[model samples]
Target: MNLNLPFSDNLPTNKLSASFANTSATYKFYWLIAIIEIVEKGQVNIKKREIFSRMISNSWYTVNYFHVSFGKQDLIQNAVEDILKFESLTKDIKKENLLSILENSKKIETKKLLEHFNLNVPHWFLSPWFPKLKDENNSNYKKRIYSYSQNFENCCLYGLYDENIIVNPIWIPYLKSNSKILKDFCYWNLSLFLQSRNPNVPDIPNKLIKPAIRNGLTKQTNEYWKNVFKELGYVECIFTGTKLLFEEKNFAIDHFIPHAFVSHDLIWNLIPIERSKNFSKSDNLPIFEKHFEKFYDLQKVAFEINKHHNSKSRYMDEYLSIFPNIDSFEKEKFSNTIQPLITIASNNGFLYMNE
Candidate 1:
């Protein structure tokens, strides 16, 4: 997973390679990503707050929606959590909109959270280039790093300032030319760091950024439930209690445990609910204690029908992973499997309806 930066005679390739060496927090990785993004936009004079704001927005979904723990030491997750109290934004809010909101927010609390990084990340990220600054115990170590970066004859990544960092004219070409590779390097290292903290969490890399487009469930899954409705004559929405008819197509398939938490579309987790109710329930966990009996009954009926009539159904295999004996699916066994996932999703900050 090492990132081999393109060879450059003028730039310090060795320092770039060591940018994330022995990192305790995720600031450096995100700081570099923000820099690359601004550079790609053809901007050289970048605001420190802009970089910090991008850091929070970039990690927003990973922390909020996907519930990836960035460890107790990581404050980026904390900032994302704190902002929720002040704004009514969705976990899956678009990146550009999120960034604009962060950049334009007038709330002092928001500004304080972002500016806190200016104390260390701006200069500390350059420690790889100025290795001597590492051991300095002076109260003004950050000032010293800034001084060295500005006075260095060759090239430092950028010149630090009170409000912004000016990208070195020499490095601009290198940054823009290899922007994609440099970003890949940051994300590759970031994924490894997150994976260590979240050893049990699946799909670490994919969870890092908000998806451009979430893949919709395959038509086969939809048709499987449609067949269930056909055999039973009707299916009731678990959340709204509205009865749905198959011929009307007035139902939408929903994730029993919000797909944001599970990050999958397994058949066992999919259910058909009233189309209107599904819109309001977007990405929220259903109240399991209240909703489980009805959900389990519906799923059990689907399983039995599909197993007996359509023995070769593609989705029937999905239950075998959760219910080992598909022939004998018990409510208690299904409860044991789903209850903890709902609990974990709640603990990770996914909300329940009417919370």
Candidate 2:
């Protein structure tokens, strides 16, 4: 008998949050969570991945919840057709395991799958469409599928919004002056911003993403902005709503002005925010949604303004138009605006940088 636990509350610690369902590990992890919940709640008859596979096979043909009832078949089938029609070598391969049959498994294959999907659909939509995945070593079969779906979905979203309409400007004097601070700033900013998407206490040093910051002038300005936020102490993320105590790292570098819509990357625009909340704002507008009742004190003022300005002043709509969503822009902006947000940085002993 399946234990009737509340859906969200029943989630396992090891699984990915609903927000991270687009990622492969998270997708598999979510099912893992469900399986664990069944065991923890005292159901001895639960079959594992095999049962999941059976569920997919049984559910695949049902049009009612095909996207959620089946797993990867719907989207992956399109990819399979593209491969069979285009790739000369794939013609001889059987249609059953086209994903596994493909060569150059990682980059080339993944990119091809992404291109075939052509964006627009959320990767999570595939959760019910695929078979229960087994643990495979060399191929990382599941992750590749998830990444492919996410990439395509993102591309579609960006294409529709014209999110990448403008490129970063070629110049910024502050980034040139403070490369060291800027580098550290960008590293931590991206790291913390990514935390909510992987809340299982991320193994620190997860190989930070390097923004294409090459010029000396641009590097300096980036540092100055980070320095300012560093001086202000700590601020909470407006989205994920996670607050780091003084014992924890209370501060992060955020972009005051995002580089996507605004051409410049400078330190003068960086700011500090709490880590968890940063995730809630993922590349979208940062204003609190109606659901954020807990942040009433912080949100009451901004929410009203967003309504008044048509979501322009202090609202993230302008930048979000070209990014993932308002929430997505908030996360990216929290990650990108490390240089200018410093102006709002507060000074207190709670935040201390070891010299």
Candidate 3:
């Protein structure tokens, strides 16, 4: 049957799975990616109910405690709860709450109504597709999806996946079928489950799952930078004269301009700064004259090392966003390129940090 997955032929070629696959691996992750992979391979009109059935059954997992020093820790919980909340609403009803709550609400209380609005829920079906696409039939089908693990018996006592038990499948699909892709679906749903489900939670698409689930970037990036830092050598904290090693744990990938205003993690903006300074820098843009030269030199070293290691570090794309017209990092004058960015931030209420 056609899965109605968008980009039915164009899933992410390099990695079948989403980023953060290692720590957040789970059923939702796998199923979403799997749907995308299947669609990319040419499937359409996949039943929404069947998709949820697949999720509910295979959703079984352990208490997923992620070492979340970065990113949203509650992403999965919010996604899942929102899915269930919307699922509980009826088509005939006016969606009284536009935002609804799940019956199993105690597990993850969405403290605020905005929590409901902010949910990045996934679309399991296409309300409508191209004329050539097969028609969706919600007719009753056997709920065949189920899940279990070799070590559930040993770990179920404390894992969150076991608590993420979803029941009865029914809900609205977000976005139009024609407007979305399997990757979008995968990331939306999987990010929620992965972020929320600690251990034992299931996850990815078939083509992506086979390898994506097995490989990850957190460790890889850390390892890559570890080597780069070793090769490029070390530096002392600019704010504090304390000697800081360039090792992963010892430092953080800091956004000198503060991500709040710059809103990008281009390699030029990124630097290995002491963790203490990173926290202290918070959302303030640094005085460019004080740090640009150092960050510029460090970015070059980091970029060269990343290119040698992975050639296509994801950060490069963001880097290009800042320099949309330029391909190579060579031509742009550092101050000329960065000053425009600082001005943009200044206009947006971003304050400068002298330190």
Point to the candidate with the largest TM-score.
1
lDDT of each: 0.84, 0.32, 0.42
Clashes of each: 0, 63, 30
lDDT of 3 by residue, 1-355 (tens): 2233333243321222223234343444544543443344343444333333333222211111111111234443334434445456321222223222332233343233223321221211111111122243322110101122112221111111211322111111211243246555554554454435322112312211112122223543465556676765775555565556755367666766655443333456656667787787776777776767666766667667676766566655555644563345663565677777666556544567746
- TM-score of structure candidate 3: 0.36
Alpha carbon lDDT at 81, candidate 1: 84
Error of 2 at 24 (Å): 35
- Decide which is better by lDDT, 2 or 3: 3
Q: Pick the candidate with the highest lDDT.
A: 1
The alpha-carbon deviation from the true structure for residue 53 of candidate 3, after best TM-score superposition, in angstroms, is 38
* lDDT winner between candidates 1 and 3: 1
What TM value does model 2 have? 0.20
Candidate 1 lDDT by residue in tens digits, 1-355: 4766777997887787777789888888889899999999999989888999999998998988898888787878888888867777887788899999899899999999998888778887787887766787755778888887776533788988899899888899999999999888889989999888876566788888888888886584456886788788999888788889878988888898988878878889888999998888888888998999999998898888878877767778888878776678888889998998888778767889873
Summarize candidate 2's per-residue lDDT along 1-355 as a digit string, tens digits.
1212122332231222233334432123222323333333444333332223222222222111111111234553344334444544322333224333442234564445644332423233333333244344324644544544334332211111111111111212222333344334433433443344323322322322212342333333233323322433433544345553434655454443322222343332333456544343322323223322333333333333333444443334434433454433243344343322221121100121111
